[model samples]
Target: MISSVLPTYNRAPLAFVKGAGSWLETADGTRYLDLGAGIAVNALGHAAPVLVEALTEQAHKVWHVSNLYQIPEQQKLADALVEKTFADTVFFTNSGTEACELAVKMARKYWYEKGAPERVEIITFRGAFHGRSSAAIAAAGSEKMVKGFGPVLPGFVHVDWLDLEAVKAAVSEKTCAIMLEPVQGEGGIRPAPDAFLTALKQISDETGTLLIFDEVQCGMGRTGRLFAHEWSGVTPDIMMVAKGIGGGFPLGAVLATEAAAAGMTAGTHGSTYGGNPLGCAVGAKVMEIVAEPEFLAAVNAKGGFLRQRLEGLVAAHPEIFEEVRGVGLMLGLKCRLAPGELVAAGYAERLLTVAAADNVLRILPALTITEEEMAEAVSRLDAAATALETHLA
Candidate 1:
């Protein structure tokens, strides 16, 4: 017997009736300290006042006018993105998957407009999770992602992670661009080495191949910077951003340099609900608060403090945790056992976490988490570890 809704996701039994700050409460009042932050979407935390105000205010004024007309809120978000990023132009979407689709189109179109239509292939790296879209799965080139979805989209070449020589050899006359995540969220919060990014940028410059960064999970102040790539001192020619950008609202964008976006003229791409007043208003508010230098510095400070605490946790529970990986608030704890074991243990302790590939548990708390909250979260994690050890013994 199938349920009313699709059973695609193996959802947790618990359901939250309300959320405040970093805490979510069930209907029966069981509260959980949320470290996943709705899978890193709620940057400012659950039910943030600023985002709420922005959403409701715009809801009262206007909602969807579509891309056929000029939208002030959309223009404001675009301007903010352009000012804060290397992108000269922006195209809004409803989710990161949509952004991936646009990024693929923009990359291939760039070559087509440059009279190099044959240069359609894009070089991607292993352990990269772009999205569930056909193009994104093809770019990942993973059997788990592309299996059963027969006849996968073509023109993507995969290589080993951080193998500069592999990337160098993979690039040919047919290569259009190289795409990767600065910090892979689903692939286990893997942060690329800064040196590797620098080398990739050099390769792009030499080969005229565009560098595309999927910052959907690591951008919008999650990495203690505006974006994760900033830490590498290398900017992407085309960037995909989402998640925290809208402070829990459905919003994503494809940011591109003028040269890269030249091919996407009028009618080349668009969306009906993208850049709607409601989403853009919330996104603008989120950007206003997150783009502050002081806010980002605080994130770095908290990230360091949290990492220090996590290192102690890993030391205390060598039987459970392997090591800690990642940067800023986007941290992951490699588990000695399957990460799902820790995830289920966290649930028993009323702690929320997300499990990923490579046997890692993602800890993506709100950027605005207080020091006291961090302590509590860690305490709960310790309790969960103890419980796991006892249950196993």
Candidate 2:
């Protein structure tokens, strides 16, 4: 049968019919432990009681309204976000890509408002996945996403990761911002070094450029923190957040310091479904839950456990895994074979994982996952690795 949707993603064969906290049930009676959590978007896990209550309560009240009127829930969620992080203001969008678009725009606009309109160039890193949007694609300079699209948007410059001198040289009078993922999720789960993040902050300040963090995939407790930048002891002038913000609902936000957001006045930008009440209501609840000190600490402890187990697997099967790297639950295995083939093998073993750039297999689990579930995931990973080891041997 013909479908209206474009053929883009290489979808998995399984169609999940129901989910309950770290487990997915297929149309058949088969159930699979879900370590993927929809690629780290389901922070609180599937069918969470608190999230269900929030959604059910808000659904009866209101759903969609034009942005012409003030959205109280949006304000509430924004307030919670500001109270928890370095941001002073937030602009909501419907997805991570839209959040990225806003971050890029706000960075350039801030510089323009400061009387330097020529400073519009945005420096991004190689292997970064900002989004599929035109400007975001240009900012990412990803050949795979940009191909077949018409002329690329101008002013985005690319540099190699960890190349401080190249990053320094790339800056010019026209440079308005330096955008990078705190952890490169699609680029193979590579975490940026604390020193590199610190240097970017310093260089941005010295060059009078805005430092932008695309925390869309790595933020919102995925890194065992509210935001990954907090671990680096550095913050960006502008930050893009999404994925786990709504705890499975689609929501995204671009946060900025007051000075940085000054240019995003009423007429500068807008989105139709950006901050609908339902999404904001759910996000507000998610923030409230994730912000608890005990909850974050639990995530940290579980992340350590998961990583240690994965490291042991890597050590035991050196021929199958080169290394296991990443912080918190957003971990990866540098593999000896093709990442896609490995992901397939894991799936066949009733385990789910994602492939990324640099031939790494991603293991991004829900932050709220239990230690027992993590142990099971480790066991399944061990089985997958042993299978690969046998194949290679």
Highest TM-score against the true fold, candidate? 1
> How large is the C-alpha RMSD of every model relative to the true structure?
0.7, 1.2
For model 1 the local lDDT of residue 206 reads 97
Write down the lDDT of every candidate, Cα atoms only. Answer: 0.95, 0.90
Residue-level lDDT tens digits of model 2 in 1-393 = 656877677788888888989888888868888878888899999998999999999999999996889999999999999999999999999999999888888988888889999999999999999988999899889788788896999999999987899999999999999999999999999899999999999998898889999998899888888899999999899999999999999999999999989999988999999999999999999999998888889889999999998889889888888998888888999998898877877787787788889999988888888889889888888888888778877
TM-score on alpha carbons, each prediction: 0.99, 0.98
Model 2: per-residue Cα lDDT at residue 376: 89
Model 1 CA lDDT for position 26 = 100
Which ranges of candidate 2 are over 4 A from the true structure? 1-3
| 10 residues in a row with least lDDT, candidate 2 | 1-10
